[model samples]
Target chain A: MGFFTKLLETSRVKSPWIVHFDCGSCNGCDIEILACLTPIYDVERFGILNIGNPKHADILIVSGTVNHRNAKVLRNVYDQMPEPRAVIAIGACGTSGGIFREAYNVVGGVDKVIPVDVYVPGCPAKPEAIIDGVVLALGKLKEQRTAKDTDSLAAELHQAREFYANRADRQVVE
Target chain B: MSTIIPFGPQHPVLPEPLHLKITLKDEIVTDAIPMLGYVHRGLETLVSIKDLDQMVQVVERVCGICSCIHAHTYCMCVEGILGIEIPKRAEFLRIIWSELHRMHSHLLWLGLLADAFGMESLFMHCWRIRERVMDVMEATAGNRVIISINKVGGVRRDLSPDQLRWIAQVLDELERELDAIKPVLTNDYTVKKRTVGVGVLTKEQAYELGAVGPTLRGSGVAQDVRMTGYGAYKFIDFEPVVEKDGDSYARTMVRFRELYQAIDIVRQLIRKLPDGELSVKVKAAKPEGEIVCRSEQPRGELLYYVKGNGSKFLERVRIRTPTFANVPPLLAMLPGIEMADVPVVALSIDPCISCTER
Candidate 1:
């Protein structure tokens, strides 16, 4: 790898700016995500900061299930992030929709609309578990950088958009 | 020029997903429209999907900050429909846990409030103290955020005298820390300047808008659902904290005083802890009635309506959360405030979007 490429990889690992999105959660996972930033869990120690803007984020942490109303918005957020981005699905709801999967409005988990690299599973997912998920995402980021899989990533994003648009359209039809 | 600025669905000040469309005339907000349904998971509709007995887990997850009280109220409602009386000891245990939940929630809110106003150290201090409350919760109920202890007839777990003593020690430590920080939140000049007279909701306005919890109490309305005394609260003696200022500062003061009130409530519950069964032997009979249950949450009063149809599944379950009730008053507070103070005034109501949309 080139020296500049190596430096860029190391910088991404050192400082992963995260954007947290609440798709349709119970606030269980959302509070736990905030708890990760506080002194006790302090994910910032790992150089992870929760930013509010998707344009500036390298990691996307989503809590809760994706519903028909939010599926397109979630897809739009994923598409806004720059390449080599990793998505971390936090909590059981985000991972597999949890108990809300059967609800009429829900379209299941974050993976329903985007490609999730790390799945942190808990009712709210412990702060420790979330920190571990970020670390795992860093590894995924390195792998994605090495493979230079922008084409496949683009394809995946395209597929996700189409799927959600269809889901929204189906909801309207019903 | 009047400019329309979208405040959120995603914003730094709001930790949750809430969208506000604020129309600005120069620096002052002319009109503010809040758009809901961002985090609507349709949880209330899951009553038919999950059985009545298993629905306690679903209700508890409605909002992590007040999970214990949610479950407590749901179980109380179900027990009411089934006509079963919970043991006195169980009632006291419920109070202790619920009070602990309220303390952690208020501390979390205080930290968020400090962050909203750019007081970083104060935010850290509030969260640092909040961790102690979480530790106490984990020690007693085995989970920090969602203490899934309540069941249909009563609570699921029993605390020993030794565990009770340990919780008391933690509460004592927390009270000392809160006493040290209370002054900074209540009397600090910057806090007062930013909050005082920023979002004044007159007593009449608060009543007409259906504000509950600290939002109502801050407006000089001494009404609290705890006064209804569902559980062991009936035996406890403590007055609701009321401030007549009806601004952001008043709301902060109400929550600050409530921290002590929660601690005192927990202590009283422990001292008056009775001896009996942890839960009654709930009979297996399909409930055939409808009941509405109300409980005081850290944010405000939460109402749950359950309709049973003599089957395992419930007919309908509706939840009216405090944030939903406070949103109208929040809109009323925003129009006259400066653009920069939008977050501070919004945070004052402690809007839990997930709770509101759920």
Candidate 2:
């Protein structure tokens, strides 16, 4: 278990491939994240790559507030990513709900549906903060190196969905 | 019958909310149905309750990348209805920012397109050059990308000689970097193979489907609303970009060529910019009428229709973004293409789902 945990942690720091998903973000944070990947910041230098295929990714960085219509789609995508993965929720919208928290369309925080490794808070967080959040997420990822042994992350995700489902107040999303 | 594939309000390839239900048989798409309104914040309902001035902020927020284009179109519609003449200097500045935005937007799309094709170097190089443009936007305006410099009558800010000089220097440097990439994009066998014959739209098809921007231009039609000579376009001596064949390659080349034209337009605006106040005081009177405004955004033709009552609130507002028009042609093109080429073809029209949904 110790050795397996180290393998996941080592991969988390080396080449952390990220797949970005927007639940209901205002695009401000999404663009900022893109800026970090651009030339000046070039997070790619740190082996951070924005990948398309979920099967190959190690990190799932979600931006925006997860809304009603997209709740299922978001879960499906998170499931498609290979085992030994981490979820990093970026922007205030993802963590709490930002300005749209009270809105009818929003599905509360992302943690309600998926287990989040780290939370990056900002109205629309700066690119530098995003870089730092990924680093922080990597740290959390390393700590859970033996992710396959107990499968705590998967269980956490199931509990999260159940939490949202059990809420009687919400009408739109299950 | 062809095979069917779903592209998305939740696609891995696109950043926007677009659900393209593509029907394909043996690598050809037989039919397509576009699913929209995912990002709809009920903005039109929101507009019905908000004043025209506040609507500008909301409309600008519709699409972060093309925020200025929406503001310009909305303001022009308002100005047209009131019969207000803007300052020449403000007009020039508007064109300068608009074109600079066009450059960065096209470059950003280019980078995404490169990434779609798995060309990491091309993606890196294009994004590297785009940062220079973003720096200029940040230096001039407080924000880097969403430079909220547009106002109702004219503009909200002015440029100093030092700033103008700095803008010119950076613009030239970007122009040089873009020039270096031009030949490679045009001549690269990989790019040509992936895009050249992929999404073909004929001239009549372009007009019939109401394709705007480079998607329209790539079809060999010279129909740029900028030639309508709105703002400073009338003052500057620039020709519209047109390419024949209407393939994905043609659209790609047209954007590459326009980067050069945008730089030239900015240089001319700087050299011949007039002297005057940046903006005039709006009367703040209630707008009570209907107005329609259109512009050539980086994507294509954007249409905005606004209805106002005698109160501060607008009666109704409607927006038809370019991607709406480009989708039909995309459906038409998707059939007969391999699955591997899906990402490039999907991105070819530069999907802006936030704008489309809002």
Candidate 3:
């Protein structure tokens, strides 16, 4: 790899901007995610910013259970992010739907729709655990960057697009 | 020509999924249609699956910010049906926890409002003070956000004498910190310029449209569900915090003052705490009547209608959240404001979309 390319990849790993999406959570995990940005937890000190746009984000932090209505939106957000991105599914709901799993509208966990690299477990995962999950996802992000060649990266992107395209119909069938 | 701009389902300003189709004429708004059901998880429908005793945990998840009040109101509804009067100590304990939840929730909203107006440092300070409340909750109730302390009869946990004293000390510290930030939130030129006279909800409009909580009180309505003296509110000495301006500034002042009011209420409950059993073991009597119970949440007045048919499961559990009642007022307030002020005005009601949708 070129020196500039290596530098960019290292920077992406060191300072990953995150976009947080609440898929049908009770707001427990959502508030905890916000708590991670406050002075006490201060995820920004590690160069992490909780940004709004998915395209500019290096990490996607999802909390809550996937439902039918928001599944398409979640997939759209994931597709918007660039390649070599990481996903951290926080809270019991995001990991495996938590208490709301049995609710009629719930579609289980975040992994049911999009690929997730880290699973942080708690009914509402603690801010500390969410921070840890983000750190773990960063390692996976670096691994994905090192492992994929340009050709392989293009192939993976195409596969992800196809998978997401078919996912809506698959959800309907289920 | 009017333009329809879709706001949210995913927006940085909103914490929950609340979409609004805002119709604007030039720079001013003409109409707004709210699109909900994004955060709906069919929680009320869980009444058929989970038994009445198990339903406490279910209802508590309705809104994470005001989880205790939801559980408390649910228990009160069931206790009314079964005619089981909880012990005095339990009532006081419930009051303490509920007040703490109120304090934390208002703090969270203050931080969000500051962030909405681009006062990033002010937002940080608001949240920094809120962490102490969260710490107190964690120390007393074992969880930070969703502290499930209420059961069917009374609270599941009791405060020891040492913990109570420690909480008192913490409240003193919280009051000092809140005082330090009070001037910036209330008297700051930027905050006033953005909030005062913006999204004015008149007294008649607020009352006729059924605005509740700070939204109602901010419009000079002295109505509060706490005045009904449910639980230990009868024993406590406090009045509803009211403002007369009926604008975003008024609403912000209502919640800001409420933070201090909640701290005061908690202190009173601690001082006048009556000694008794925490709860009474409920007899296995299926609730066979339909009843409605109401409680004051941090957002507004929350109503729960429960119907039982002499079975292990409730026939129906309908929740009328404060946000649902406040939405109409919010819609009414939107038409006259500029597009830039939409978020601040919408946030002034402290809309909890998850609670509304659930």
Candidate 4:
């Protein structure tokens, strides 16, 4: 709705600095993402840079099944990124835990950790779908300017700390 | 000041998840501690529930890039369980497919390493060659990746004469082009400065840490899983590739030589292929026993331990990926290295966190 907001959204669409994280995935999805960055797909031409630091990233691309052990670390990373941030769950495992859902260690899906803006579904979602999901995230970022003004990630992080501190409260009151 | 840095269990650069606590004293690694058990999916459990027929698919999905090798190794284990002899044609095809996967995987590693160092154009060029390998995978397996071609007794897909010839020809081109490109990777001042002499893993250190694949090969060891002669490896002749320097450059050179070796092995396989049944009808029942079979993945030696109950489901499955073996070495090497050199040194072991985690 605002001038700088519109400009930032447009630039974000054109220049998405992505930080890719692997919660726990078979490299199938990781390699496909690598393919998109390579010359054959060349998603980088659109200025989708893979940044090493999470603090500066606008798009968070995650692959693999989120396991119980990594759920906290995943939330912590999602909390670290600045506002106007978007999460793209890449691969079947990331979206819904895929083949490994029934396993004891599997965490079911990435959304269980944080809200996902887009989901690219495939055993190993092809590079093209990954790009499309990113494009969709940018569009959503533009539309959500006035939808929710609060910093949800920070709030979630705060809530998480409380949930852990009062672990005894989870037991039966009776 | 002593600084602590965490690597993986969830981090960039590793497709798998292994938590490494690295301690550095002003850029020199002082000590490294590794924490594992992240991607443990109870693969052994799945193997028991599924018959040999179905487990073939499961093994291939274990790691996408190395799908063919897992399938091949599983096939070897199964053939051992049942007294079945694979046809020479099937054996040749298996070898050809494995080598192609190696070529593609090594190139993928080369590009990522280059990209890590901020060599954008060079990275792009390496991946362009990778596309050719993917094309071959697509043409044969009907999937660019996760080929899913390896089956119980033999391969699921049969290679036509034209496909075989095309594969050999394509590999020839890739070999030539990759050879010409070697100078750029080796001679370039930046790559040398970034990689050479950094992350030096002495031969004894490598052995002590249980390093495998090019990581071990770089440390002056001549060990490779292929020497075990699983699949069609017995028929197709090849030698273990090694470099004595035990630095990042030596590791790079090992991959380079192995790439050419992979090409040659494929060419010989296609030429010597004896025609017959590509896949035999597999009877899957709860076989009573446990077995372990492994092969050299692009990263290193990968072992799959399977324990099967008399029931349809597997009792236990444990995978020891090469990345796990290299972790201790990585921790050892990480200390005494500059912060800037961490990724380069880390990647030199070709970390596949997913495989480790899984």
Q: How much TM-score does chain B earn in each model? A: 0.99, 0.96, 0.99, 0.93
The models' CA-based lDDT, in order, is 0.88, 0.79, 0.91, 0.80
Runs in model 3 deviating more than 4 A are: A147-174
Q: What is the TM-score of each candidate against the true structure?
A: 0.94, 0.88, 0.95, 0.91
**DockQ for the candidates, in order:** 0.38, 0.21, 0.38, 0.33
Tens digit of lDDT per residue, candidate 3, span B30-94? 88999888888998888889998889998999989999999999999999998999999999999
Residues B20-103, candidate 4, lDDT per residue (tens digit)?
A: 666667667676777766655545556535666777777677788888888887777656655578777788787787888998
Q: Of the candidates shown, which would achieve the greatest lDDT relative to the real structure?
A: 3
Q: To one decimal, what is the Cα RMSD in angstroms of model 3 from the true structure?
A: 4.2
Candidate 3 scores a chain A TM-score of 0.86
Please provide, for model 4 over A1-174, each residue's C-alpha lDDT reduced to its tens digit, 9 standing for 90 to 100. Answer: 689867876787679898887776778888888889888998878999887577788888888788877777678677767767899999888999877776677778898889998999987787888889989988877666557556776696677678667844223222
Tens-place lDDT digits, model 2, residues A1-174? 979856756766798999888766656677778778877898989999987666678888888777766777679779877666789888777898754555556677789889998899875677888999999878766665554655666686676578667844323321
For residue B276, what is the lDDT in candidate 4? 83
For model 4 chain B, where is the 10-residue window of minimal lDDT?
B40-49
The TM-score of candidate 1's chain A against the true chain A comes to 0.83
Model 1 regions more than 4 Å off: A149-174
